[model samples]
Target: MVVMGSGGHTTEMLRITKHLNKERYTPRVYIVSSTDTTTISRVLAGEDSSGTYTICKIPRSREVKQSYLTSIFTTALSTVSSFPVVLWHRPQLVLCNGPGVCIPICAVVFLAKALFLIDARIVFVESLCRVKSFSLTGKILMFFADKILVQWPDLCKVSKRADYIGRL
Candidate 1:
């Protein structure tokens, strides 16, 4: 499973997918924000749509510049709604970067893991832009993500949970 945010996040995901051996990762599931209009085209254009992937959308937990306090309610609601989606996909692994939508999906995956509904792993890669510090989503996921990969050595120092993977 691949979860993407808009713009740069989507671009990075598409770039990462180019290296995937589709034979090993069949029927890929991509999670994107419902409000994002551009990512779909980018996926269709850049990815091989040879019937090997599925795209799913969930509500965006918080918009850019959305108040942190109000985001609490929105994130909770999105997490609830994401349960069914996550259950349906039942991804063995969820790969995501910093994005509000990824939070709800990853949360559902964690909850499913706790409840023994399914065994899913989360691989979170901090964006290259986050050289000095983690984004809000990255900070929140640092504890829950099975693997926290950082593109820089500095970030690894900031969070022991993060491994310096060097620009991935």
Candidate 2:
């Protein structure tokens, strides 16, 4: 499964997936923000017509220009709604880069792991835009992610555990 935010986050995640071995990563699922129709369209247009993958839309944790109170409320609701989707899919690996949408999904995966419901390994790739430090999403997920990959070597200094795997 892949969690996509908007614009750059969605593009970067999709680009990384292109390199994945189709034989190994068959039947992939893309989790997108409900308002992000652009990504949904892009995925559908780019994917093979064989029905090997699909997209799942969920409410965004926070919308642009949204108030803090509303963001909090929406984030909570989004997280709750995502629980069942994550539980049902039970992906062996949950891959995400820096995206606000990833937080809630990763939280669901963490809870699932704690409850022994799923054994999904989270591989978080810090956004390529972050050359000096980790993004806010990356910082929060670092503690829980099974492996954190960074595109820039400088980011390796931010967290000893992070691997500088070069650009995706």
Candidate 3:
């Protein structure tokens, strides 16, 4: 499963997946926020609707300029809504970059792992735009992800576990 954020995050996610070996990563599941219609369209455009890939929508963690209280409530709702999907799919790998939507999904994956409900590996790739430091989502996911990849060599200093794998 892959989390598709908005704009740059979505673009970077798509770019990285484009190089994946189809035989190894077939029948991909893409998770997008409910308000992210543009991302849904972009993902669909690249997918082979012949049952090779699917796009799943969940509520957004928050809207632009949304109140903190509202964001918290919605995030919790999104997390709850995502539980069944994560449990049902039980993907071997959950890939994501920096996105608000990733917070809830990653939390679910972490809890699922702790409970032995699923054996999914969380791989987080920081965006190429983040040259100096980790984004909010990246920082939050650091503890949960099995591997955290950075495009910049400077970011290697940010975390001992971070890998400077060049741009994706």
Candidate 4:
């Protein structure tokens, strides 16, 4: 199973999984922001639940806040609160689009001994958190990520396991 953030990234993540041999991949959705509109729950309740479940009610920030401290605090708090949910899901791999929803879920994956796989397109700094926090965050993900797929080759500079795949 895999966890991803919202919007185009989520769409791409879903598309990639669909091509995986169903005998191997079982896709599920986990919504990570409070305000970001997503259909993970509906998808889970309706068609997607064949081997899937919904993880709802996550706190997502709307815009980059004026106060960095406040933004960090809220994001961190939301992430910390979400640890248990990730444990319950017990996914084998997590594919993050970027920081929007993946941050918190990655933290939980860290604590749960699950693998973390990040998409390659988000090689820019904006895709991640602060540099000070990067080391620890990267440590958690890097130590466990089975693979890091990149849609862009430039991402290889920052990625731990860079694989060149077409953009999702």
Each model's lDDT: 0.88, 0.88, 0.89, 0.52
lDDT of 1 by residue, 10-90 (tens): 887887787888888877888888889999888888667488888888888998899999999988888988998889989
lDDT of 3 by residue, 3-61 (tens): 99999989999998888886689779999998887998888777765778878899999
- The 10-residue segment of model 2 with minimum total lDDT is 41-50
- The best candidate by lDDT is 3
What is candidate 4's lDDT per residue for 88-115, written digit by digit as tens? Answer: 6556556554445565666666655533
lDDT of 4: 0.52
Superposed by TM-score, candidate 2 places the C-alpha of residue 59 at a distance from the truth, in angstroms, of: 0.4
Tally clashes: model 3. Answer: 0
Ranked by lDDT, top first: 3, 2, 1, 4
The residue pairs in collision within model 3 are none
- Pairs clashing within candidate 4: 33-58, 33-60, 34-58, 34-59, 34-60, 120-150
TM-score per prediction, in order, is: 0.96, 0.95, 0.95, 0.64
RMSD of 2: 1.2
**Top-TM-score structure, candidate number:** 1
Q: Estimate candidate 1's alpha-carbon lDDT, on a 0 to 1 scale.
A: 0.88
lDDT of 2 by residue, 17-108 (tens): 87898668877889999988798887776678878886898999988788878888998989998998898888889999988888899999
